[model samples]
Target: MTAFTSHFAFEFRTGIRNKNLLLMNYLFPLGLYVMMSLIMPGINPLFQATIIPSMITFGILASTLLGLPDPLVQAREAGIFRSYKINGVPALNILLIPALSTILHILVVATIITITAPIFFDAPLPVNLPVFALIVVGTAVALSGLGILIGVISPNARLTVLYSQVIFLPSMIIGGVMLPYSMLPPVAAKVALLLPSTYAMNAFNSLAMGGTADFYAWGGLLTLFVGGLTAFILAWYLFRWDSQNTGSRRHPVLALLAFVPYATWLLIV
Candidate 1:
């Protein structure tokens, strides 16, 4: 317990202390949030209603995708995991402690956006406060799972960026953050069916805010839960203690199973 706490504490500090992590986890997200809050409402009169949720979603993307993955890959390359194993730290703990720390950072950032958006930008808050909090954590966990999974599967830091951006850029563009799901073209909307942010924004809009969901709002949250579970399970199965010393490994393509819940929902509905 003591060792776990110490490791957790150190990881939490890293979320703020490491320059890149700090930028992605705090400065980048908050800066973008503020920029959007200041400029967007003026551009789209309807933007205010969605600002809180969208920016909060963007913060999750920044914290998890931009902030989370490369460290794990780099650590593996540098033999950090090898040292941890020598000292008996479980891979589960190695993976989870950083994720938990990132989750904390996101919740704090989410809370900040939820509160300040209303006051500073006249952004609307969720009518369902408890559900809002629940879904924020839900989104955090779901996306963080993807982030860790990316780190686990990526062979190097460059590929980590590729994988993270594959989700990050699309989420920003079409995942119901910057653009409303309603306004997207029919084909683009279909493309969004595979993105977790689409579910997250739908949940926040329909279940928490007063907006209508493109799909079943509650069901979207459930999909996120299943998706997150699948991701963590896959991460555990594929975990390598060191980049060079990995034994027989599962094909990284198997990680796509994490999207089964999302794809299933897309097919069913």
Candidate 2:
């Protein structure tokens, strides 16, 4: 317990101390929130109604996708994980601590957006606050697992960026963050199902914000929970303490299994 607390505390502080993590965790998300708050409401006056959830979703993507993977890649490259293993730290702790800290940072940013959205921009609050919080935490856990999976499978920093962007950029454009899911073209809508942000937005709109879901809201939430569990399990199985020990783990392509829940949800839901 003492070791766990120490690791968690260090990772939490690292979220702030690392400049890129700090940017994704706080600056980029908040900046976009402010920018969107000032500019988006003018372009689409209805934007304020959903700004809180949308921007909060954006913060999660930036922090978990953009910020989380590179550090783990770097740490592994630097042999930090190898040292930890020699010193008796578990692989689960090595991954879980950083993910928890990142989630905490994301929630802090989410809280800021939630509180200030109404006061500063007249954004409508979630009618069901408890459920809204549930979805946020659910999305965080799901994405944090994805982040860890990326870190586990990606061999280098460059590939990590490529992997993260493959999800992040599309989410911003078509995952119901910048625009409503209903407004997307039919083909794009089908593609959007692959992204976690789409389910998040769908659940937030229907289950919490008192709006319609593009699909079954409860099923969407379940997809996130199941998807997160799958990703975390895969990441745990794939984790290596150092570059020298990659022979026994599953193929990196196996990481694609993380999307099984989302794809299955698309078919059944």
Candidate 3:
């Protein structure tokens, strides 16, 4: 436990120093939230309430999808994992340390947005703070696993970034991050259902609005939990500590396994 804490701290410290990570993971999401809240047209108080949580989830999505993977891929390229293995550290611990650190940072970002959105936009605070916190933590776990999946499958830092963007942009547009579900066309709404970010928005928005969360919110949380589990399992199986793994068939196919839960939800919903 002590070793895990030490490693988690070290990863967080190192991540804070990376300018790219700082920009994409932390600053970009926060900036997007503030900017959209202030500048987006037709935003009323009620709309602003939902926007608060949705954008916080957006931060989690960006941080995990874009921010989390680069450092792991970079560490792989730098042979940091190899050094840890040679020092007799457990593989599972090494895999989880970076994720935990990333999740912690996302939580901090979420908290700041949650606290300030009300003041900035005259939005209502979450009716239930505890539920809001659960949604944030749950979303962080799911997104962090997806990030690790990207890190594990990507052979190099460049591809890791490329792959992250592939997931990020779509989620932002269709997953109800950039706009609400009611505003999207039917086809786009259906497409959004296939992405975990859509459910995250549904869940967070419900809790932020008030009253007991209905199926959309609770169901989203459950699906995200299952999706996170699947992504982590695949990441564990596919991860390579060596930087020399430059083969064409480096288990990139395994990334599809991360989508199974989302697909299943689409089928059921």
Candidate 4:
């Protein structure tokens, strides 16, 4: 536990020191909101009400999926993970540091969005704050698990970059961040439902639009719990702490199975 805490603190501080990462993890979502608000002036209220939550979700995705994975891949490639293993650090603890950092960053981003969004858009406060908080926390957990999976499995930095885009871009669009699922084509809407982001957006939209909060809230929670658990298990099996020594022990079967979530989304659509 001490090692985990120490490592988490070290990584957290390192993350804070990196100016570009700091801006991307914390401020980029808000910046996107500002840009969207300006571009859609007439729908400023909608942007504030709906888009803020979506952006919050996006922020969580970016921090975990985008920010954490590349570092882990690089660390593995450079033998940093081996050094930690030699020092008696548990494998889970090694991964936990970056995961915790990403979660903390997501919380900070969500809090900033919650506080600032209402002022700009005059959006109604969440009727069930506890439920809303749960959904946010759950979404972060799910995304972080996915991020860890990506970080562990990606063979190189270039592959991590490619996979990050492959995972995030379509998820963002179909996840209903840029537009409401209702406005999408039927196939697209069905596809969106399979992604964790879709449930997150539903939960957010419910809070913002005063719909059946219970449905979206519970839906988001379930998706987060189930999806995150499955991804974490797969990641644990496939992750190579010493990739250099593994010497071409590739698992194409596991790689294909990793796409099940996306494939499930297509089937639903």
Candidate 5:
């Protein structure tokens, strides 16, 4: 436990030190919001109220997809993971440190977006704060789990960055961050339905607009949690502690389990 705490502390400090990462995770979402707000000035309030959750979702995606995976991959390539393994650190503990830290960073981003939405844009506060908080926390956890899976399977930082984009970009676009699911074409909307963020954004937008939050929003939270759990389980099986044998030994097949949550979601919705 003490070792875990020490590792967690070190990871937290490391994350704080990365200026570029801090900028992307902290400022990028706000910049997007600012640009969108300026362009849609007349409908800024409604837009702000509607898209704040989407922005927050984007922040979560940035933190988990890009933030956690690249560093872990770099560590593997740099032999840090081997050092930890030789020192007798538990695998789960090793993974948990970054997962927890990323979630913390995500929450900070969520808070910033939530508070600023109302003050700066005259956006409506969530009608149900508890529900909103639950969804946010759940979304953070699921996304972080996805990050772990990405980190474990990626052989190096470059592939981590590439794969992270492949997953994050599609999820963000289809999840309703860039546009509403309703506005998307039928096939795209169906694809969006498979992504957890789609439901999360839908729920959040509904709550912000002062309507009864759709059951799908809560369902989205559930789907994320379940999917994230599956991803972590698969990651445990596939996790690589070093770059050695990375290309030949990867268990990309196991990664498919991560999609179970989406499949379950199809059943629900």
Candidate 6:
């Protein structure tokens, strides 16, 4: 427990030291929210309220899955993971650093959203604060685990950047960051449902729009829990401590597995 806490602190510090990443993790989402507020001044307050939560979730997703992994992959390639492994650090402890940092990042961002949300928009406070907090924390944990997994498996920094952008941008845009789910086309809506961000948005929207909790929020929480577990298992099986050591050609197979939960949700929900 001490080791986990110590490593978590170290990782959090490391994240703060990276100025560009720090800015993006902390400010980018807020910037997006502010921009949207300014550009669409005439939109309903309820719709604007939903945007804040969507942007918060997007911030969580970006920091964990996109911004954090690229450097981690590069560090692994440079023998950082090996050094830690030899230093009597457990693999799980090594993973904890980034995961914890990402969680902290989410908390700080969420706090900012909570404090400023009422000022910028007249959205009501969440109906069930405990459940809302749980969804935020759970989503962060699950996404952070997946980020560490990506760091372990990505071939290179370039690929990490490429892959993260490919996964994150469309997910954020279509998952109702800038546009409401109700406004999206049928096919686009179906595709948006296939991403975790959709669940996050729905959960947030439920809280903001009606001050009510619903199954959509629960579904989002479930998707994060189950999807994150699957990613962690695959990461354990597939992670190579040394980058020179090529992993199984099973990368595509594993990728498909990662997509399954969201895809299934799209089909059924």
The candidate 3 region of ten consecutive residues with least summed lDDT is 207-216
Q: Report the C-alpha displacement of residue 57, candidate 3, in angstroms.
A: 1.3
lDDT of 1 by residue, 1-269 (tens): 69999999999999999999999898998999999889987898888999888988999999998889999999999999999999999999988998899999998999899889989988888999999998998898899999999999999988999999999999999999988888899888888888899999999999999889888989999888788778888998889988885565588889888888888876766
lDDT, candidate 4, 51-72, per-residue tens: 5577788888778777878888
- Candidate 6 residue pairs in backbone clash: none
Per-candidate clashes, comma-separated = 0, 0, 0, 0, 0, 0
TM-score of every prediction relative to native: 0.97, 0.98, 0.91, 0.87, 0.90, 0.88
**What does candidate 2's lDDT look like per residue over 133-192, in tens digits?**
989988998889899999999999999999999999999999999999999998898888
Q: What is the lDDT, from 0 to 100, of the residue 39 in candidate 6?
A: 60
Model 3 alpha-carbon miss at residue 244, Å: 2.0
Which pairs, if any, clash in model 4? none
Among all candidates shown, the one with the greatest lDDT: 2
In candidate 3, residue 118 scores what lDDT? 83
What is candidate 4's TM-score against the reference? 0.87
TM-score of 1: 0.97
> In candidate 1, which residue ranges exceed 4 Å CA deviation?
none
The ten-residue window of minimal lDDT in model 4 covers 260-269
The parts of candidate 6 lying over 4 Å away from their true place are 43-46, 207-216, 247-252
Query: Judged by TM-score relative to the true structure, which candidate is superior, 4 or 5?
Result: 5
Query: lDDT tens digits, residues 1-269, model 3?
Result: 68878887888886677887787668898899888888763654445657667778788888899888887787788998899889987878777887888888888888788788888777678877887788788888888889998988888777887888877878888887777666778787777776778877777777655744324678788888888888888888888878686664645797888888787766665
Least accurate 10 contiguous residues by lDDT in model 6: 207-216
lDDT by residue (tens digit), candidate 6, 127-151: 6677677778767766776677777
